[model samples]
Target chain A: MVMVPVVDYLRLEPEPHLCAHECTSCGARFFDRRNACAACGGQGFVDAAVATDAVVTAFTIVGFAAPGIEVPFVAAILDCGGTTVQANLRNVTPDADHVRLGMPVRLTTFSMGEDTAGNEGIAFAFEPAEQGGNA
Target chain B: MSDDIYILGISMTRFGKHPDFDAVDLGAQAALTALADGDVAMSDMDVIGAGNLLGGPGGFGQMLQKQIGQTGVPVYNVQNACATGATALRTVIMAIKAGEADMGLAVGVEKLSGAGLLLGGSKAADRDTWTPSGRVGAIAPTDGRIGTITMPGVFAQIGMQYLYEQSYAGVPLELFARISQKNHAHSTLNPLATYQKELSLEQIMGDFMVAYPNTRPMCSANCDGAAAAVVVSGDRLATMSAEQRRRAVRIRASVLTSDPYTEGCQVLFDVNTLTRRAAEAAYAQAGVGPRISISSSCTTASRPPSWCTTTT
Candidate 1:
């Protein structure tokens, strides 16, 4: 089965992880490809793989959404060491009781769907991991 | 030095649903009322500025001029995010400061009622180039898709991030609800507010959650409204009747700023940094300090000393 990655930064080859465009000057990391660093506007960048393990820094369980969207899902910002990302928290209840700040999570993959041409779409998410992830 | 700008009169239509009037009608109504409030005839104005967020085709200022008056004077129409009204006023103030005109009028109108929220659709994470179809209106959407750009989600993340950074037990939810309760309570005295009734903390916390920690009541409501102000150069006001000079309010210092580069700004989008920077510059310009406990007419009296007064 041919699998297609969801976002450009998501890499499935070396394992399911995210790649960051680290700014050469000021060391700012951006997930999306950049013409220059957002923090410093420096024109140079270094490709770096983000840590797979992370801790929840901030989160919100959205109950309202637009058309074609599902209600009641946990959207979170995770701190992978020094870098931060926006992702969904899976394998846990979408509530304050189950999801929280500093909750340990690890990068994982899920199938979005297979295209009509037999190409399967794969997206990355952070699922509930054991205790002691990134601080 | 250029003459200081002063607000001779200010007024607004009731902030609620206006079933009959469009944006232009509302703006004209507010502008007429402001002229009456200032006791200044439309012919007495030399310049005008109008602001509208979704102000349809054709210039809103000229359309407003059709309703108010068209003296063939300079008319500026502007829109700047949520600051459309303030920017419109600034346009007129700038005209006056340039010594081009002594008196100018500014009106801001928006028919938000019956208008759909701008919370459009999400795009594919990996796609760089955007297709109009990919942006909005898709079925079976995920919260992760809309979390990046939507206001409810952005504010929720911002609040939660602050708490998380302060180690508030995984983004303490109570703090956010408390803010809503305070806003509702303050609205009780404001006649122009759509909802003047105070809401309890329990009610706010129990309301339907739009984003985690922020309930339905916490989100912004789309209401139809228009407000206008008559701005006159202080030098001009002094030459007018004593009553006009007595009632005019002085503008201390008006400043606008955009987000500047800061560490981790890419992640959280620091809303506070620009505010802090603006406040510091305003304080220095106005000769004010953190000790001045200032509050708006409709705002509550209680607040901390200041938020980030130091220069970054």
Candidate 2:
């Protein structure tokens, strides 16, 4: 089997670190960082890892392909607790016809080709769990 | 004092791609032309209102104000998607009619086609929610989620629905093609229009279909253009002649309404009704109706399936 096609060059380090942001004022824990906070229009923001869980709010099966590449499949918009993250859906064969909305999915990592500016495009992918399994 | 505001002058930049110039340069060109056309010096104007659809550094209105050396006048920025020009006109008219300012200037400018993200409306990112089939196993490219439903699709759906329900005799696509051919012909007379050449119905209808029932020639070209209009109170026009008055089309009524989000194609729904409402209000304000000599709309004819294909 061509595991290289499936796995080679696609490096994924599953570091499930806590994702959080630090506000310079009041030192608040904001899950998402922004230029100005909804609470306070604070200018200072520091990115830090935070622990969180995401439920699949919605998903899609992407079947786009480039020249010489097998069509990479991905599911997107896995909602973590409340903050939504877009990720590739792995481990499940794609059925273009049948995929349920709001299906239970988890956060994972995936890879994409270099952009026109020649930058490696890395993204979080959504992994579908077997029935009754929650991540 | 219940009186109609009059358009003193109108101006527009050549509609095409201009990579080097930003929104301000395009805006000022039209503003200067309009001021010159109106026979008014920049120092005499009471207020400046600048309208821009997308992208720029801060102070778009100020950018134009500085360009013309009119730093003393209060400048307001108006941004309203495709209707940016019309909205700016409305603001100037209202201000003049209310006696807030005797002389007001309105300008709309946009550069739609050079290096930037494409627009697919408000629900673009929500495409994953709208069509899950498109998202699987794909790295969402920057332009991937751009709305493909052309202006034609919006109108075609309306036409299709009309055909399906009303049992209309005319083929909707043919009607759309006729509209495009007529507009393309109309643009030839307009030197500032991006498309200068005329197109045959066969040329318009036979071109590769962007959306069903709409062809290439049927749609407006992607353009970088700016439009400006100068307005003055009725008092300013007392000394002017019948010929000069004829040049200034009176704003009988101008009304603007927001979308309620009841339907999927809110733009088509809103525009058809808004045009009617504006017309009605204009007549009521001017004590006159459609018998007035001329009417004009600066609608975005950028793409398919829009009322632009149908309205003209």
Candidate 3:
């Protein structure tokens, strides 16, 4: 299967991990790079790997979407070891019974769409960790 | 600090779709209206600042100048997302404060409808390697859904958290609908608003859902419009007739700020914090207190509504 990452921040090879840049001076983690640390104006940064295990901090059932996109999906903010990342909640229905705040989740990947050549586009999401499945 | 700056005139086009008008057209229309309101000729303008997010062809400010008869005055384009209008005003204020120009024009225009929706279409080459996920780029996917969400989804997440965790005066989700109703009702009195019909709470709640707790009525419409203001230095105002002086409005202060970076925890950042800080700074500069009236366009569910009141 030909796989490509949707964004550079999501590392899919070998193992799924969220990559972040950490300011050397202020220890602030960011999904984007900075010429200077926003917290302390530090010029240096170090690569940081965010853990896959996280909990849903906030979420919404998006009922509207662009053309050809699905609706009523759970769009959620995950607190992965204090580094919050926004993603979609998977393996669960979009309802109050299936989703709740502070639910444990683990990072997972799935196919987005395929080109004419059949190369699958990959993106990241989180599913209930208790389900215990391969990422 | 030679003399205080005052707004001599202001004008805005009706806030609705103008299918016949482009960005430059709307900008020129507003600019002309402002100049006429100020009773000043285009030749009197020493500098021009134009604010816009999306436009076509030539530079927005320069194109506006072309339509309004350019007199060799300096023209600048300013873009700061939704803050484009305020940034343009700030730019002109700084120019006049620095004694660079005695009379300046600031105008903001947008053709959001003309720009088709393509939110997550940023090219990979344009993507910042350091922050690939920072913009509209895709992320890890789950189930059958792509992991990309737009601005409304982001705010909806925040609103969900606020609803789940915070308890202030027992405010319910209905408050959002009520707020939308109030806004629509107020728009009835404002001929410029895109949606002027008063919406009942039921109507707002029953509207098509965009995000959880946010329906169609609760969100702003993407319409085409422009607004403009003419500012002059105190020295320039002194030369104007008594009628102009009576019509002038002083700009006591203008401040701009941004959110500080925090560890990825979205809940740690309160959107109101930045606005509160900016408001405090403006109040101090204008020698006003918290009790003073405020006028703002902030639509965040977490912040209370505020209106502006001029203090003499």
Ranking according to DockQ, highest score first: 1, 3, 2
lDDT of 1 at A88: 77
Which digits, one per residue and each the tens of the lDDT, describe model 2 over residues B101-139?
888899888877652324322333422221112312223
Worst 10 residues of 3 chain B by lDDT: B303-312
C-alpha lDDT score of every prediction, in listed order = 0.74, 0.57, 0.71
State every prediction's TM-score relative to the real structure: 0.87, 0.59, 0.83
* Candidates 1 and 3 compared by DockQ, better number: 1
What DockQ, on C-alphas, does every prediction get?
Answer: 0.43, 0.03, 0.37
Candidate 2 CAPRI category: incorrect
Model 2 stretches with alpha carbons more than 4 Å out: A1-135, B55-58, B115-117, B121-152, B239-249, B260-271, B291-293, B302-312
lDDT, residue B167, candidate 1: 69
**Tens digit of per-residue lDDT, candidate 1, span B167-225:** 66533556777777877787898899888988888888888987777787777677888
Return the DockQ of model 3: 0.37
Give the per-residue lDDT digits (tens) of candidate 2, residues A1-106: 1111111112333454334455677454443325564445677877544323455433333332222223324334344554334344566664423333445665
User: Which candidate number has the best DockQ?
Assistant: 1
Q: Give the Å shift of residue A71 in candidate 1.
A: 1.5
Question: Considering every candidate listed, which one attains the maximal lDDT?
Answer: 1
What is the Cα-based lDDT of residue A97 in candidate 3?
A: 62
